[model samples]
Every structure is written in C-alpha cells, then in structure tokens.
Target: MKEDYAFITEQGESTVHELSTVEALIKYQEQFHTGFPLTDKEAEMILGYMEGHDYVLGEVQGNFYQGDLAEVRERICWEEYSMDDVIDAVCEWNYELVLEAEAQRNNPEDFVDFAKSQSRYERLKAEEATLD
Candidate 1:
C-alpha cells in the first residue's frame, strides 16, 4: 500500500509533474510488455508518460496488457507524495531497463579497441578511394 508520489525531475532549478502512487506507475508500465508488445504510437505514449506528461492507459491504443484500465486510472488519479516515495516508484518502474543498460557497460577496453580498428579501417578506405 504505497502512497502516491510526485513524478518530479529537474526543471529550471525546480521540479514538475503530478503525484501518483507506485501502484499506478507499475500498472501503466505493465501495459507496455516485453517481446515487442507496444506499437510505436503506444510506445511513444509510455515514453511521454515517463518524460512527465500525464497519460492514462486507456487514452492510448494497443491490446497488449490484460487488466482493468479503470483501476489503473483510479490509482493514477492520486495526488500526494514525498520525494522518496516518487524515487521508489520511478526506480521500480525503470529497474529492468537500468539493469539491461548496465549489462551493456562492462566492455570499455573492447569498445576502445573496436573504435581504434574502425578508425584505421576508415582511414584505409579513404586512402584507397583517393588512389582510384
């Protein structure tokens, strides 16, 4: 039974966005499933919601998630939250993506080598083109 939390982020030395419960954010996020579930429009809507625009699940298209949209809206309609509450909700909502991104970050040496190789290859290609 987590309380509603504000979806606040930096905005001209302040914060914005309304308050919502973790339950609602989880429900909204659940609408966009894995395995290529969301349509481009639907995916954009979810991204918009993440970027602080208030959009309910029913307001968008896509038959991906199976649940009561009314309940989701009800939870979203809440308007009271602390910063910690908001952080918890947002963190939970984005945990999987964060993990996925972190998983792709452990190859700095390989990336550097690959980049150097690519630069040399491009330079060689340019030199060959000039010889033509």
Candidate 2:
C-alpha cells in the first residue's frame, strides 16, 4: 500500500503531501514561507511518518500532492564576473528566450545588470511585464 501524507496549514486547512519525508515536507512548506505551525510532538510525528506506511493527522486518498514547487535560482554575484561573462551566462541560461530578447530590446548596454536579479523563469516574466 502507498504511504499517505498531508500538510495541515496554519489556517486549519489541510492538503495532501506526496513527498512523505519531513525534510522534503519542510523544504516544500518553506518554499511558500508557510512553515507548518505544529507543536514539537506533532512535528516529530510528521517526520516519523517517513519510516514507512504511517499515519499522522490528516490523510486524504486519491488526492494529488498539493506542494509542487517552482524553480527558484538565486542571483549571481555581479562583482565576481566581468560584464561579458554575465551576459554570456544569461544568454546561455535563456537560450533565445524572452530574457535575452527583452534585455537586448530595452537595455542592451546594461543587459547583464538588467538580467542579474531576474534569474528564475517566473521572475523573468515579471521583469518583462514591468519593462512594458
């Protein structure tokens, strides 16, 4: 039988969590800055369930895992590399994507600096929208 897991949020709401381990759960919860507001004993129990088919508080069957995470890459140190290198990295990461196009279209001279903070795909979307 498949082990079941759930995340009870601070708002008295619960959701399915397929990644059973507390470490992965913690990482998942932390992604939204929505740390589980559980007691130490409850937290330990959640972690304990990682062993095998175990139970905690909430469990709902036939439910998809509610904690899918987006890729969130951090910004690289601008001072660590020369202007040329950063642009190269950004272009390589973008791969003819909108970041390269937007940067080139709006700020070619400072394209490296412009793309510096916009590392993740989600952030790139926001940056592009704001640029318009």
Candidate 3:
C-alpha cells in the first residue's frame, strides 16, 4: 500500500509524502536537515511495517536529490525504493513544483490577461454579458 506521509518544514511548508514503511522514514529523516516529528518508539512501529524494502543512498543535507523532478516523481510511485528515498525524492520533486506553482500564483494577473486575449475567453465573456 502507498503510505501517505507528511513532512512539515521549519518554515511552515507542508508537503505530502509517499513512503511505504517506517524504516524508510527513519532513513529519510536521518539524511535530511529536517527531523521527523515522530518519536523513536513511533518510528519503530513504522519500521515494523516495513520488513523488506530497498533504499537508495541520499545525502540528507545536500542537493544531491534536487532538480531531478521526473526521476523524483517516478520514485514516489515506485515500490522498489525504500520509504526514505521515496520521501526524499518526492520532497525534492515538490520543492521544484512548489516554486513553479508559487511563481504562477504570484502572476495570476498575467494568466488572466492572457486568457482575456484568447478568443475563448472573449466568447465566454460576451455570452455572460448577454445573460445579464
């Protein structure tokens, strides 16, 4: 089953995690600058659920896992990699995606203006005006 994990960074950024077992989670927490909010006992219970899984070696404090958005996205859905790798990959993937999303969000007026210039939006506007 796909485990839905969540990582909340010190900056109040929250991202969804897709790791399978507790061991993977521990491994991931060990590598990253951010620590898991879970206690050791809780982490152990998670480890119990993950009996056999493979993990990729990733440095927690470095950008080794950065910019490989495609690979990261694929790893999130993969079962072969341990939960830590999955979380690391997914977090890295989302870091980039979030940047892009934030950029787009900050420029909504640009999209709105672009949409207004499109014939589709013009047509819709005219239709809506007529309904008034």
Clashes of each: 0, 0, 3
- The CA lDDT at 103 in model 1 is 47
Candidate 3 stretches greater than 4 Å from native: 1-79, 110-132
Q: In candidate 3, list every pair of residues with a backbone clash.
A: 22-46, 24-84, 31-60
> How high is the lDDT of residue 111 in model 3?
70
lDDT, candidate 1, equals 0.37
Q: Per-residue lDDT of 8-118 in model 3, one digit per residue for the tens?
A: 335553344433345554556666534344455555433332222333222222322211223455443222234455444434543454455545555557776545345
Better of 1 and 3 by lDDT: 3
lDDT of each: 0.37, 0.37, 0.40
lDDT of 2 by residue, 1-132 (tens): 224333444555454434455454444444544433433433344334222222222222322232212222331111112223322433344344555555554654565755653454455564334323
Please give, for residues 1-132, the per-residue lDDT of candidate 1 as tens digits: 323223322332221222133344445446544233334443443434344434232212222211122446554432333223333443454454444344444333588765655565554444333322
TM-score of 1: 0.23
Compared to the true structure, candidate 3 yields what TM-score?
A: 0.26
The CA lDDT at 75 in model 1 is 45
Give the least accurate 10-residue stretch of model 1, judged by summed lDDT.
59-68
Can you list the residue pairs that collide in candidate 1?
none
Clashes of 1: 0
Rank order (by TM-score, best first): 3, 1, 2
TM-score winner, 1 or 2: 1
TM-score of each: 0.23, 0.21, 0.26
